[model samples]
Target chain A: MTLEIVSPGLSTTIQDLGRPGYFHLGIPEGGAMDRLSLRAANLLVGNPEDAACLEAVFMGPEIRFGADMVVAVAGATMPMTLDGAAVDGWTSFEVKKGQTLKFGFLTEGARLYIAVAGGIDTPPDLGSRATYPIGALGGIEGRAVAAGDVLPVGQGTGKAGRTVAPELRRMPGRPAELRVLPGLYWHRITEAAQESFFADEWTVAAEADRMGYRFKGGRPLEFVEREQPFGAGADPSNIVDGCYSYGSIQVPGGTEPIVLHRDAVSGGGYFTLGAVISADMDLIGQLQPNTPVRFVRVDMEEALAARRDQVAMLDKIRGALA
Target chain B: MAEIQAPVPGTFYHRPAPDQDPYKAAGDAVAAGETIGLVEVMKTFIEVKAEAAGTFKGYVADNESPVTAGAVLAEIDA
Candidate 1:
C-alpha cells in the first residue's frame, strides 16, 4: 500500500515513458534514462509497460514496504537485499509487510530501475509521473524521494521469480561504442573535425546527468567559417536555436559534445554533429565517468533496423517469461 | 586491515573542494558514516562515507585521479 524511504539514495526519482507533445513548451520528455530497462522491470512485476518506476543512480535507497508486494529491479547492477537477504536483479520477487529493501555498491552501469507491481501510485502532471527536477514537474512533488516520505503503491498483478534477460545488456565493454547517425549540422564543422568525431575515443565527462552527457578527452572541434547569422550566438558552434531530437549531439564552444537524453531541452542554439541512434541510447545511459566511448556512423536504414532489433528483443523477453 | 572502496567510478577528490583541507589524514579517528571524500561523476559529487569506526589510513588513489568501481580509495585500520 505504501513504501517508506528509510534513506534517500544519491538521486532516486519516479519515471515512466515520459510526457511527449510538450517539448514546444520548453518541457523535456523526462522519463527513465533507459526506457528498455524500465519496460523490463515493469514486465517482470506485471505492471503496464509505462508504469512509473524508481530510477536510482549510483547509490540506491533503503525502502520499507507497508504491505505484501511484487517487485523487480533492472538496468544497473547495484547489489540489493531484502531484509538482509541477497536479492537478484532482473528477476521478480515478493516481500511481506514491513520488509525493507537495501542496495549495496554498484559494480556496473549508471542508473538502476526498481518496479513494483501495479505501479508507483502518484498523480500525473501533463500525463506523466516522471520527474524533471529542473522544472519541478512530476514524481513525488516533482523531486527525488526523500527520507521518511511515504510513497503509495497500486495493486500487484504479477507473480515473482521471472527474470529479464536481454543478454545481460552491455556491461562488459571496456570502451563502449555508440552507433551514431551523422549529418544534422555536418556541413557546419570542418571535414577534419568531423572525421575525428567518429574516429577519436571520447571519455564521458563528470558533468553527465539525465539532461545531457558531455564527453571530454578529445580536441575541440573546429567549425567551418561562415558569416554570423541573425539571432545565432557569436560562437562558431552556434545555430539558430533549433529543435533538438532526443539523442542529438550538440557541441558548444566546440569544446565537448553533449548527447541529449530523455530529459532533453526542446531547442538549443549549439550546432549538433550527430545523434546517437535510437537503439543505442540505452548504451549511452549506462556510461560512467571516465568511461571510454567511440562513435560509429550508421545509415538511417541501419538505424531503423537496429530499432527493430531492440523491439524484437522486448518481444523476446516477453516470450521467455510467458 | 580494511580499506574503503569507491562505490562508483569517477575522479576521486580528497577534500570537499579544491581549497579545503583533506577530510581525513592518516592516523585520524574516523567515525562511521562520516564523509571523508567524494567521487564526482557527471557533475554529481557523491560523498564517500566511512563504513566503520577506525583509524584513517592515507588515501590509496591519488587526488583527482580516475578510479574504477570497487577500486580501493583509502584504507582504514579497524
Candidate 2:
C-alpha cells in the first residue's frame, strides 16, 4: 500500500526514535521532537513505538490512501478531516482506498504526528527512518515530504485495534512550568541570574525551530570576562554552531535562553546553562510562539525517576495494544 | 596565528580515508574555506572548513582524537 502526498505542509518528514550513538560522526540525532505523542499514535495503531511516522510542522499535507489502513493523529491538535468529515485527534481510524485526508489550521501545539499501521516504508539510514534535513540524510531522500511524493507503506498482518478515548488524547497547548536540570555551565552564571531564570517568565522567540527554540526572558545575563573566554584554558564561548541534544538550555551571550530539540546540531560553542529534563521535552515541542514558560529546577535523581516513569507509561500502553 | 577549531564536537580525522595523505600539513599554503579536517558525529561526517585563509601551521589535536566544542584542531599562520 502507498499514500500520495497531495499537499506537503510547512515541514513534513518521516521520523522515528532517532539515530543515536553516532554523534562522533557529526550527525545530529534527528527524530520526532515530541516522542511521547509519536509513541502514543503508534500504539493506537498497534505499531511499534519506534515505527516511522509523518511529522508535520505548522501544517499537514493532504494525503490519499491507497488501501484500507488504520491511522492515528497525535502531537499538535490540528484541525483534520477525512473525506471532508471531521475526524477525532489522537485516535485510530480505518481509511479506505481513494479517501483523501486533509489537515486544517493548527488548533494547538506546533507540530503533528500521523502514524499509520505498518509504518511509513522508507530506506533506513544508520538504523533510523528519521530525516535530517540540514545534512540531507534518512527518510525519503533525506528531505522533507513534498507534494506528489508517494510514500510506500510496508506490509502488515492487517490486525488492528479500536480508537483511543477522547480524554486520553494529549492536551493541546504548552504547559506553564517547564522542568530543567543544571548543565555543565550552570555554575558559570551568577546565583542572581540563576534565580531570575526561574523567577521571571519567558516567551518563545520567533527564532524557534528543530535546531533550537530561543526564548525572550528577563534581562540579559551578564558574565565575567574570564567566564566567556574561548580556546584552551578559556571558558567556552557562549555562541557557536552545533546541534545540542533535546532539552539543552543554552545561554548565548549570557542573554536569552534557547532550548535545543531533537534535530539540534551535535555540538556547539554556546554555554549550556541547563537542560530541560528529557521527560519534559514533549512539552517543549508543544510550545507555541510567544507562549510564556518558566523553568523549574530538579535534581538528577528526580529527572531520572521521571524518565523511568515516562518509559514505564509507554510500555504499559504498548502492552495494552498487544 | 589563528586556530581552526571544530565547528561541532566529534572525532577529528586528518584524512578522509584511512592510509590517505592528510588534507593539509604544517607549512602548506591553505586558503580560507578550505576543508582541513572532518568531525564525525552520529555516523555523519562533517567537513571542518577553515574560516581564515592562511598557511597551515600545525594540528593542535591528533587524528581520531575525541574533541569537544571549541576545541582547537589546527593552527594557521595568518
- Model 1, residue B14: C-alpha shift (Å): 1.0
Model 1 CA deviation exceeding 4 Å by range: A166-172
Q: List the residue pairs that clash in candidate 1.
A: A206-B42, A206-B43, A207-B42, A207-B43, A208-B42
Q: How much is the lDDT of residue A97 in candidate 2?
A: 95
The CA lDDT at A44 in model 2 is 82
Query: What DockQ class does candidate 1 belong to?
Result: medium
Model 1 over residues A1-322: C-alpha lDDT tens digits?
A: 9888899887889999999888989998889888888988999999899999999887788999999999999998888899999989999999999999999888888889999998999999999999998889999889999999899999888899998765944452768888889866989999899888888989998888899998988878988999999999999999888988899999899888999988888887988888999888987777788889988899999999999998998888777776
Ten-residue stretch with the least lDDT total in model 2 chain A? A227-236
Candidate 1's DockQ is 0.73
Give Cα distance to truth, residue A267, candidate 1, Å: 0.9
Per-residue alpha-carbon lDDT of model 2 for A1-322, expressed as tens digits?
9999998865689999899978777787778988888988888887788999999865678999998898888887777899999898877788999999997666567678999989998999999999998888888888999989999997654344455555444442343577889877777777887788888888776567778778886777756455334442343345444446667888866778888887777677777887999887877777655567888889999999989977876666566566
The two-chain DockQ for each candidate, comma-separated, is: 0.73, 0.01
